[model samples]
Target chain A: MTLIQFLAIGLTILILLKTISDFKKNRINLLAFLFWTGLWSSVIIVAALPQITMPLAKISGLERGIDVVVYFAIVFIFFLLFKIIAKLEKIEYEITQIVRKNALQKQNNRPQKKI
Target chain B: MTKLIVIIPAYNEAKTIGNVIQGVKKYTDNIIVIDDGSKDNTYQTALQSGAKVYRHQINRGLGGALGTGIEAALLNDGDIIVTLDADGQHNPNEIPNLIKPIIKGKADIVIGSRFLKNQSMPFFRRLGNYFFNLMTFIFFGIYTTDSQSGMRAFNKKVAQNLKIYTNKMEVSSEIIKQVRANQFRLKETHIKAIYTPYSLAKGQGFFVGLKTLGKLLILKLTQ
Candidate 1:
């Protein structure tokens, strides 16, 4: 297979994995999926294409396959971190809303009683 | 005005619980000292110090002790709750610093950080703290200089929802993770940490940190 074909297959696999995650989490958003899929595809293409890949790799002083894999792993981990943070933020907001509403209801339900 | 209750988790600190309890008297009369199932005279010393003491009947680790202490404090009318180590490493004179942020309505929880300033700590101890702080920051984006500090203050609302299940030293990580998840306002204050040779050697070893992270990962995955 050609380098471009390998890049295409790898990018497609990453997109499929991400899509599976989004589906499992029930967070389907067309624009976000398209953006991430395109981003990863470009990254794979940029790393796999021989003509541009070697020169860029030499210029940046990064080894061929290992450096690319390392960079990809780092970026993937950061993306996962942000996704976790977003989920935590959502939960925090929901909890705060429920607590506030509960407090308000309790305050309203209080009656004037002789102490 | 928020009423404050000091929860001192004493574990065989009979030699020091008396001074610790007496030390906190000027600040607040409401204090709960959990004897943590100490085999020594911990309960007797605490009672002599004029604190309402409760016995756990068995050793429940520091986290469990703190949980029991918080519950007792709340039942005793705690509006703001502070947890202090009974080993005397924590200076009760600095109690006000721990609780001031809550009083100012700025933070729901305030943690006393030993490394927040130029406090003297052992070499290995400092290195361990730096490592854990980095791990915590990388995982949660919440950078606390001293994640293992024993002095902490929490308001009533936070105190109510503070469920600590990690019955050991790992509870420190669990505490920060919960704080981040709950989005509670956090404030760190520079406080002095008195570390004797004994206390320095008592710090968690490297394997303990790794085990704590492993437990944390398992809990996260299971949850």
Candidate 2:
């Protein structure tokens, strides 16, 4: 095998081990573990061959395989970032509600001031 | 008299919140203040001023605080909910004019319009008002004067149905958006916005206006 192919195999093996470890520790659900394992296995296949992505690139109307990977990588990273931001906003909103509820409870205990 | 409740959303208005609570007290005894995590002494001052006070652990901006205040007012059996700023920009005396139409059953929602009269409102602020007004017309296909008015009065139905998701100054315009969407009978009365250097500084800046528009648009499209 070529040096580049050997390096890809090593990297995919590392990812596979990490995914399996996470699954064993119950840090990730079965579906997530399966997804990561499948993803890394696919990478191992493509990295060893370097020709599988060509068909994908052609189907996606891209000229080069690496270009297709780059485009999809950008899109996936951006989608993940958007989801993180939305989750953060929701958490902040829930925290606001909790704080507001606690404050109201405290205020409710105090007698209404008669002016 | 109607069970009128004054809801004030204050953020870091320690210096002027007491006077606002007192001013509203002159007209009605039921007052609710939502202190949006003020680092200053706004919570104690409003509570001491005889208004029921709720505090947020962190600053939630004008929109978040207003949402909390509205919920509290509805729970407190407020027949008519009148909202005003904690800063002294809104004249509490004009509150009667705002809720008059609601009290008379002429309108379901009454809003205080600063542009209805000739006042010393700054030139850029007026221009900004027109900008958002035109945007509202384009997006919602509804035309109304002073879309960003802070002083407003509405009934329990509105309080029960109106959804507030924003956590910033955009809450003012969101109120108009939701009112139009819900098809509530809206009234515009000529009321003055007391403008001072401090009030102006507390008001939304030019960049904040743009950010509010972006947020409102996102809210419209996504949810």
Candidate 3:
């Protein structure tokens, strides 16, 4: 109908296709693939039929359907951000372990004076 | 006979590594220098100074260096392991007194505290240290005069038991936490800090202190 709605639907379809491709290539697990598929499918539904969000906005005590969608998006984004940060910290810890192991192994292999 | 191993974790301290190694050599020949990916000639200087050097391929922070140093010490069968700053702020002569508690079986770990006695520390630095001490107490339920002290000596058992997870300055606080969790005997002794212009510039400032605090908080939440 509207230009914005058409663009949102197109973008959602593209993202959904990418998520499926990632799942096919084994880049993401079943749980993650299902999550993205559900999320993008909902986005497509919300974009295609803007009136569907009216009940959600009313129940959430929001003035407009767009506000409800925006609030959920913000919450979802924050959750994803927290996950990313936690994963990054774990990766950093792993890297430190690797570096420490290598340094110690190199030293052990070298001949040195007795302590 | 107790074997005392001194571990100096150096990062870009080429100017002082030679002198520091020589100073520690006065007390013990088992000196370990963990060259934490220094861009300078720290590794060469330490080697020339006759200290065994273990170098990281890339820069891991203070904690990472200390972790490597401790492992190296334990591998060499160190009876008592002492860690001090490479900036020459910690006096090597005080090391004998620092490990006295461990040698006598009085304590498993001895912390060389700068705040145990009256010392000339910068006003803000003193205040910041006090703040960190209080935070360590609040988060881990263990209070000490200097939670961030770079000079500490621990027995072999303590070294093997302690796990350093952080790769930054927060490792100091994390060490205190591990000491408490492992129920290790801890003691604090007064030691003077030689704050030269070079060493003063290397100490943690306001922003780094804040980052250390943030990391400590995360450590508390996660662990």
How accurate locally, in lDDT, is each candidate? 0.74, 0.84, 0.93
Classified by CAPRI criteria, candidate 3 counts as medium
Please name the candidate that would achieve the greatest DockQ relative to the true structure.
3
Among all windows of ten consecutive residues in candidate 3 chain B, which has the lowest summed lDDT? B214-223
lDDT at residue B223 of model 1 (Cα atoms):
45
- Model 3 over residues B100-166: C-alpha lDDT tens digits? 9998999999999999999989999999999999999999989999999999999999999989989
In order of appearance, the predictions have TM-scores of 0.64, 0.86, 0.92
The runs of at least 3 residues in candidate 3 whose Cα sits more than 4 Å from the true structure, single-residue gaps closed, are A1-7, A62-69
Model 2 regions lying over 4 Å from their true place: A1-25, A40-49, B118-120, B135-141
The residue-by-residue lDDT of candidate 2 on B1-223, one tens digit each, is 4688999999899999999989998889899888889999998998888888888878988888888888888778888999998889889999888888988888889988888878777899989988988877776666778888889999888898888877887777778788888998999998888888889999878998898788767556555
What value does the lDDT take at residue A86 in candidate 1?
56
Q: Is candidate 2 or candidate 3 better by DockQ?
A: 3
The TM-score that candidate 2 achieves is 0.86
Which candidate should be chosen as best, given TM-score against the real structure? 3
Report the lDDT tens digits of candidate 1 across residue range B59-142: 656766777677666666689998888877878889898888899999999999998788767777788888878776666567
Enumerate residue pairs that collide in model 2: none
Better model by DockQ: candidate 1 vs candidate 3: 3
